[model samples]
Target: MTVPALYRGLFDDAALFPPGDLPLPEAVPAHAVHRTAWYAEAVGPFLVGAGRLAELTAVLAGAPLRVALVLPDGAGQLAPALADAGALSVAGVELADPDVRAAVTALDGQLPAGVQAAVELPRGDGLPAALDVLAGTPYRAKFRTGGLAAGAFPTETELAGFLAGCAERALPYKCTAGLHHAVRHTDPATGFEHHGFLNVLLAAVAGPDEKLAAEALAERSGALLAAAAHDLTDDQVRQARERFTAFGTCSIVEPLEDLAALGLLTAPAPQEDR
Candidate 1:
């Protein structure tokens, strides 16, 4: 299950989200399986909603689990909730708050030490301001790459601008939603065009200008994306990862399978995946 160094800790388990909303009972063990998989190095922390803290605690009992918190209902009770879940190690937090400044202020006040945070910015005129607000803070930027419907996905132009904004600010970021495959492709069933994770990875690494970035995101060829990834030097890959970080996926295997298919990652030995 060897993967390019650029993809280490790239897939954060989001099995609790839509499209594959595995119940805690099912998701907990499935995440554990991913933690031990042959390509386990590519897997990041388990994403759990702030409200689901108690349920996750119950599922784990006394065992410790690495987690990235999602504040779907704002940042209410986040500190207390994490305090109560002594068995869970906090890796980071992600949330989309309309009042970016206030939310970041409150986060700085309540966020525990050593726990990283990301604030999602809308794909609109306010993005610049939001990124500006985050410029000096420890908080990073987050963007939504795709969703269930066509409307849920950002256009190539919009996505490219977002990447360019982050690159200009030297802000590290993460992406969630709609990136199911390694290369951009239109889904036949939904007629929705999904951005590819590999495309985004390369874009972040190169920090291309807006036009070139948009072109990269719109690329549908797996070979081109893989070749771009292969061309990057180790330092460039590391720099790109520092900016791109990881992305959330409903199923960890999907990304791994896609990488294997694209020859970016080596397939596991038969029966070795388990």
Candidate 2:
């Protein structure tokens, strides 16, 4: 099935990450299924930590897999991680480092051609400078939208600032963690607030205005947000996606289910037996 351009390649599989923590053995096959599934176009590369490349290779046994290598330990681990990724296709690299400039410098001349890199900037006073450093470069930016703790989830204002910053620089970016559903809501079990992926998309399409973006992020009405998404024109979707890019989610099915619930995605009719 042809996925909508707005949602195509929007979800990066992070089954191995926290919460879901699907074992590498299970994740490998599950990812393979997702790749061939009808919703395949909506999925992006399988995410794995840099340290897990060897383990991932051992399990794959030469089966081709595209991966987004996560460098948690920062720039020092990038070279060795890429070296270990020889057995698999490295689709992209994500570097989480406090020193954004240094990480960008270290990343220069290191990644293989066609493999995009995103530096996870510290969401602090230095964010603008970090964005400035990444502007006009081939690299993209990454933001941590949510995590295990309450503090890990950036407030609507903060996230709006981030979207505005990226828009101003025209720097493309992807999000990680905390965006579990299609609409913004507090998790009933954990009581932790989570940013809805749909809200983020609408906010990005709102352009560089921090206030408008913040309002979109703060909106909790599913019908309203879904309506806004449906109202988006082809050019609007293209421009928004060009800046917002994709986001990482632990469960690919969760987002798919959410989108289906929002009436954004319709399941294909089952085939009749011959």
Candidate 3:
């Protein structure tokens, strides 16, 4: 029942996890990991430069690890560390450079073996091109949008479209931002904002039920979670359960371990590989 824990990006601060209702031991594990990166969501703007990043990296690398780095640009940011690391930046395009193809191929030469890389695509059509550019590496991809504000949620159709696009492209991308709580609960304290996996999960399962699908998409809170999950047939329930058994978790790390007490996800296998 060792659940997959949440990796708080630079945005989540030390205070974010401390106020939870969960027990002290469970609420704040010996080490709660945070990240170091430059972004609006950055936990501490003053401490996000190169020096803080190095320190945070070192801390997370240690036992009882409580900090981490979700480098938006994995390799490009770390290229200096790994002489072979290659970094791809978006100097032209709004979200990415307009001429990424040339830049990528240019770095191909100095890109040492196992050099990591990341490309930020500015607008539409960049998805495919990005997939093509980072094709043969351990590179992972992320999609960004402008509407993660307090109460801004993309249209139901828009989210479905995005996820559909991911499915169509066979892209298993990870999401950051707007997802912080277990359900769609509001951040009682910060009033900042957070969207948990439960909503995403419900939306994914709602494809067959258009009405149900629409309701979940329009709302930005966890209200839909309880309802969307309602009315689902036994078969659908089973399917959703299977999905959860797979990679489903809106990591409230402490309580998630609680669910495993109920025989939810299969017990993780040994770490022989590790």
Q: How many residue pairs clash (N, CA or C atoms closer than 3 angstroms) in each of the candidate models, in the order given?
A: 0, 0, 8
Better of 1 and 2 by lDDT: 2
State candidate 1's TM-score: 0.94
TM-score of each: 0.94, 0.98, 0.46
Candidate 2 structure quality by residue, lDDT tens digits, 1-274: 4577889999999999998999999999999999999999999999999778889999999999999999988788889989989968899999977787778887896888899999998888899999999898899899999999999999999999999999998999999999989999999999998999999999999789999999999999999998999999999999889988899988999999998899889879899999
Q: Which stretches of candidate 1 lie over 4 Å from their true place?
A: 268-274
Give one digit per residue, the lDDT tens place, for model 1 in 1-274. Answer: 3766888898999999987889999999998888887788899999988778888999898787899988755556456656765768988888667888877887889888898888887778989998898877888898898877778899888998888888888888999998889999988899998899998987786574788888888888899888888788879888889889999999999988898888788965677464
Q: Which residue pairs of candidate 2 clash?
A: none
Tens-digit lDDT track for model 3 on 78-104? 334332111221111111234556435
lDDT of 3 at 36: 20
lDDT (0 to 1) per candidate: 0.85, 0.92, 0.37
In candidate 2, stretches whose alpha carbon ends up further than 4 angstroms from where it belongs are none
